[model samples]
Target: MFVDQEGPDPNFSAIAAVADGRATVTVTGEVDMSTADDMLRAAMTDDVAATTLDLRRVTFFDSAAIHAVLQLADFHGPKLTVLPSAQVRRVLEISGLAGQPWLSD
Candidate 1:
C-alpha cells in the first residue's frame, strides 16, 4: 500500500508504503514545524509490524522533526528504523540521538 500527502506547496512530502509487514515512510524536502505532524501521521500506518522512516531526501530538519522521530521511536521501539540524510543526521547528532539503536548505519 502507498499513501501520498498533498497540499499547497508544503515544501515537503511524505509517502508511505507497506510490504512484508513493514511500513516504509519516505520523506523529502524540509521537515520543520509545519511538516512534522504530517510526516508523523504518514509514518503511523496501522497494523504494521515494523516501520522504516526514510529521511534520506530531507534537506532540513528542525526540533519539531526530532520530536516526531522521538514519538515514533517511543511508539515503535525496536521495530522502528530511521534512515537519515546528512541534514537530519546533523540534527540528530546535536540532539545526541545519533547513537540510537533505531538509527540505521
Candidate 2:
C-alpha cells in the first residue's frame, strides 16, 4: 500500500509503499535541510529485503538528503536502490557516489 504525505510545501511530497518484498519511497520537489528528515522517515521505515527510492521527480537535493541516503544504506546494507533525478545524480557524483551499485539512472 502507498501512503502520500502533503508536506509543508506544495513543491515537496513523499509517498511510501511496500510490494514484492521491497519497500518503495517516491519523493518529489526539493530535498534539503527543511525536508530531508521527512524524506528519510518516509524512506527508511522497515528493514525489508530491499528498499527503493524514486527520486526522478526531485528538483533539488543537498547534503542533508545525501546523509539520509547514507543512513538508509547503513541500515539496509546493499539492498537499497536509488533512482535519481539529473540534479540528484550530479550531487551524488560530487559526493563520490556516482556510478555506485546502489544508484540507477
Candidate 3:
C-alpha cells in the first residue's frame, strides 16, 4: 500500500508499499528537483512488479517527474489514478501518456 501522510507539508510524507507481491505508491507533493529520486524509487520499486500510484493529491509536477513516470512504462505497466484536477490531467497528457494501463480506473 502506498501511504501518504494527510494534511500540510505533503511533499515529504508519502510512502510506497510492496506487499503480497504487488506495489502501491501514493504520491502527494510537488515532485521536483530534490524529490525526484524518491519518486523514481517509488515508481520503480520491488523488481518491476505491477504497481498502482495514487497521485490524487499531488499539487505540482515537472518534466523530470514526467520522465520518471514515462520510465515506468519502459519496464513495467503502471496503474495511475488521476484526480479531478486539470493540471494533473495535463501532466499525463502533455507527457504523451493517458491510455491503457497507465491510466487506471
Compared to the true structure, candidate 2 yields what TM-score?
Answer: 0.86
Q: List per-prediction Cα lDDT, in the order shown.
A: 0.90, 0.87, 0.63
Model 2 lDDT per residue over 1-105, tens place: 433365445689889999888999999999987788999899876757899999999998988899988887787778989999999999999999997788986
Candidate 3's C-alpha runs over 4 A off are 1-10, 47-49, 78-86
- Best-performing candidate as measured by TM-score: 1
Estimate the overall C-alpha local distance difference test score of candidate 2: 0.87
Error of 2 at 93 (Å): 0.8
The better candidate by lDDT, 2 or 3, is 2
Question: Candidate 3: what lDDT?
Answer: 0.63
Model 3: pairs clashing at backbone N, Cα or C within 3 Å: none
Deviation from native of the Cα of residue 62 in model 1, angstroms: 0.3
Clashing pairs in 1: none
Task: Give the lowest summed-lDDT range of ten residues in model 2.
Answer: 1-10
Residues 1-104 of candidate 3 have per-residue lDDT tens digits of 43435433445544788887667777776776456568778767656346776677777777766776667656575444333235667777776776646665
Query: Among all windows of ten consecutive residues in candidate 3, which has the lowest summed lDDT?
Result: 77-86
Q: Which pairs clash inside model 2?
A: none
* Per-residue lDDT value at 52 in model 1: 98
RMSD after CA superposition, every candidate:
6.4, 6.5, 7.2
Residue 17, candidate 2: alpha-carbon lDDT: 94
Better-scoring candidate (TM-score), 2 or 3: 2
